[model samples]
Target: MNAILIYLLKVIAIQAVFYLIYTLIFHKSGRHSINRFYLIFTLAIGFLIPFMSIPKFQSYEPYLEVDKPIWYELSDLAEFSNTEAELIPVERINQSDFTTELIVAGISLISLLFLMKLIYSHFELIRLKRQSKEISKNGHRIYCSQIESPFSYFKSIFIPKSLLDSTSFDTIMEHELVHVKKLHSIDRVLMEVILSIFWFNPLLYLFRNRLIETHEFQADAEVIALQQDPIAYQEILFQQINAQKVISSANYFKLNTIKTRIKMMNKNQKLSKWHYLFILPLMVFLIFSFSSREGEEFVAPLKNDVSDVFDYVVNLSDSYTPSIFPLKDAEGVKLTASFGKRIHPILQVERMHEGIDLKTYKGNPVLATADGIVVEAGIINEISWGKIIRISHNGIFETVYAHLSDIEVKSGDKVKRGDIIGKAGTTGESTGPHLHYEVKELNKGFLNPVDFINDFDFKRYTSIEKKDIIKLGKPNQKLKVVIDPGHGGRDQGIVSSNLSESEIALMVANQVFENFKSSDEVEITLTRDKDELLSLKDRVSKSEGADLFISLHMELHEDEEEEMMTAIYNYQSEHSAASQYFGELLSKEFEEINRKFKVGYTEGNYVLKNAMSPAVLYNIGYFSNSESERYLNSEKGMKEIAQELSDAIMASKY
Candidate 1:
């Protein structure tokens, strides 16, 4: 279910409960003021209750003293828990699918139409006021027009020209004056606007109808009280019952609810104030059912000496500051998008881009811009940022890294500047591989990340020259190798008219797996054997305890002549030397088979950087080249490529 849809449902449910209460208990009450207030108050509170949050108690085992229970108030606990005391503003996302988005668009369209209608209604009133002859009476401007009925909007009362000379003219003025003096037109307009937005909810229409009925009842009661003749006022209302009236943003002297108005007017007994006491429990029920509750960890109980705990409480230091660029490699930094308002590339709308995009290769390391505590490091509700990390620094500044393919740190973890937190990739609502970086201050909202970043110091954090090789097994143990076929299931990476990158990668990866499956010296594991959308994290996890991890992929190049077998290794990894060695051997094997081959290094590439062993991502061929595509599709080409790659992997071990 969509988050927006869920929120709408919650609001609708709350409104329904309020409606039920009104219809059952308060609708028939003679107290019109109380009924009117209940309807209007509930109408507003129904929409607000979902956003409301309350605090809840949670037991903390760390501070629990079983023998002597010590009660610590929330004020006292704030000094002990620094993060809990401070408020961090996190962006709330309403995750919606295509169908949900379409539904919301439709709803907005309908609401816009209703708003237009309301505007037109007011325009009609303004036009009528201009055309009519204004006659001043009782310090009020009365617009006498050639109409069948009378109505009031603001201080302007519109009456039929025939009634201005008739005996019932004064009586008609009295009813409409009540609407003007009491500002019933404002209520009418307010309800109309509410109805326009929530027209889909039938109960809202009912609420509007009920409000109109109460307005008529109140006006009738006032008129009867002034005239001191209930019978004559009833007769006047009955006369207007059959008259056709213009339904603009005006309270009319019409009788849509004539029977109810008469009954309410005749009733002398008022409902006891004690009957309203039921609302207290109802409000409590709504708060508990709909309002959000955040767990507050209880650090103390009821009894014991807790003065020592307060004395030792130390505040969190806010001295750490960022010094280096988030990306370690200065050469790889390519600014694709900058912060601030711009036409969104994907949505094609003028929206705020709160972060700066650093375009880098897939599987590049995303460093913490500053020494900070990891506030949030995981996948959120929306896939727009597939994996994100938010670090709070100096208790005032915060940095956010979004659209990552892999996350290395977890929430609450401490990190230093330039530390690898994740790998950048084309995850979420992205066009290609890049990192969306943001810088935020405590009071001031999102600031440009470029403002805080200094020149990248590549020498300070140079790539590891050598990596310790993990012991495979005993002297005669088989080498465990994990082969990952990139982009499966719904994720058809680098798609062409005839074939997808996933298909080509899988076909070649399967052939490599087949070659190693029968070998006594090697044991092979496929991250995904069939069509399935396996996450980058899942692919890296499967590489655990394996001697080597090889991710097979196919890519498209703009140039048709760019057809070559390429091997990419994570240069920053501790196993960089072994990965580079394997890539070199693989390049040589491809050369022996008379295939165009090249070996390169990348700071990005999720699987290569995060895999438990020496890893490499090998691009077999460019799908963009017609001849290369044909060769990749052919059975002979797959077998030959797989054989050479397997030969190199076996040779590289020596």
Candidate 2:
């Protein structure tokens, strides 16, 4: 809402500048054609200026102020590697305050009322034309009515019935004819609409009034230019103003600022064509006003009492050379998947595997691959990284460990190579328990994790550069979501005699996919389609660029498992805020199904540990329980579940 106010202020300022230029220079320039065109141009520019800063058309010129990286999403003391300037703590006003909302509502209501009034004004004019007697005279459709003001609208001149036989009516008719021929009503209509839209800006009304004044001056000038008596024209204008009723919809002869019109009549100057060159500076000013990201305040980092851990992590990350296998038994663990180009497990298309997947059983100790500061530690996506942790060795490289059964360290915790950061497990999208590890060079996409560390040597690679971090570009669009349907292929998780976990999961996933596909609001993707083996590495990879991840699964009821629906989210001390919000919503939705939904976090999940989005594993029910199994198998139950889950996902949009 503050953004909206700031934008409106920008538009008002731009239009105000244009208004000043129009009134001070061109309004009285005696060139009606030039003034008319200028007025339209200014109005058009005012409307367009607001849309200029939109992404596709945004200017490439650098903003004087560089926004410091918003590290609030990271640890409490997290320090960015390539931040150009000191981060400023901005104390913005509460956007959700009642006063702010009231102001916004008031603006909307007033703008709407103004628009309705414009519509009514149009209807009123039409009714007047319908009631009047029409007669064509001197190439115009003249409407003879009991209305007081003699005015012109479009190609029609509306004359009062009392003035039909009056001699002075001929002069009024001639003046109205000039307005009709010039199509001055079109300008009035355009200005009126602009006024309605920007009703908050009083200057626009002034701008419109000045434009109308110029229109009358032009019409009067044309009439006098064709006649011999200038004094008679002045007298005729005064006589029209003497009447009471005014024509609000048309260019009426006796309407507004007549003294100024008379002054323009006598003071007509022949401005040179070079005067048009003055528009060059105005154009520049308009572009700068609308497009430039100027006046952004560069805030310095606030001074506060510093902690030793924060200082240690900042200093260590800046200097530490990182390279080590993140898992405890890196040399002994089976190489489940090597990092390189391969056929995508689900998509079938060949894609680069940036990280290596090592098959590790659930609860296996997972170590930090490097000595650095913990940047982000939490659940990223349920279908990608179940419990995840990212460590920044320097601004150049960030290492990610996903699908962990546990996270032992908090964000900002400085750790040396081989420190136990987590335990390996299949917490997210996985066929079984495993560890997915990635080492990424900032802005350079992904680098082979093994390239940075091996059994023989941990620090095999050289230090990364700050310049590489600067090249890290952002995604093109907002709100990309990845949905994963668990247990595909030969592995029919928690299957009974008739019901298959993989099939039920796929059914829900497909329904969710179809719903999302019908709406263009977000870009959506699925980790797997049909029954197939989807690697934990590939599932996490598919979730790249997504803002959220929804992993659908059916949990087999262990002796301790509860017979109810549940949602599992990331549990690190500094977990993803979006992931937390989504998990709560998912919990609420599942509770609506059975009124006994459980929302919680486990030690860690492997797949969601490294996903870039806030993720949740939506456990429909315990497959081991007979009642839950029947609910999963029932067609009506599946349909309702899908609808409820879709509603839960959409709630994040609002």
Top model number, TM-score: 1
Give the per-residue Cα lDDT of candidate 1 at 19.
Answer: 92
lDDT (tens digit, per residue) of candidate 1 on 1-654: 223455568788999999999889988787777788888989888876754545345432221111211211011100010010111112224323478558768988999999999999889988988899998987888998887889888888999898888777888898888888778888889989988977888888888888888888778878888989998888878888887767756788884788988888888887887798888899889978886432231112213676433321221122234545677554556554556654333221234667777777888888888766676777762445678888766344678888898999987676777789999887765546778888877447788776666443212111122113423333577878889998899998877667787887888888888898788988878898888899889999998888889999886654577677767677568887677667767777888878876555555556777988888888788777888988888889888888998887787555
lDDT of 2 by residue, 1-654 (tens): 433454567667887888887767776677878887887787667755543321223323321221223311111111111111111112234423488568768977898998898888878879998999998776668899888888878887889898888888778888888898888898887777767867778877787777788788788888898886788989887887766644455788787677888887788467776787798898777876575231211112223755543543224221244455566664345444556664233221234666777666788898877666675677756654578887765334567787788899877676778889989987765555778888876546688765665343321111122222221123344457788988788877767657788899888888878887867565568898888978878887876667788888876543223465656565442334456456666656766656455444433566657666677777787666777677788987788788888877776664
| Superposition error at 201 for model 1 (Å) | 2.0
lDDT of each: 0.71, 0.66
Off by over 4 Å in 1: 57-102, 297-654
| Model 2 C-alpha lDDT versus the unseen true structure | 0.66
> Looking at candidate 1, what is the lDDT of residue 195?
88
* C-alpha lDDT of residue 623 in model 2: 62
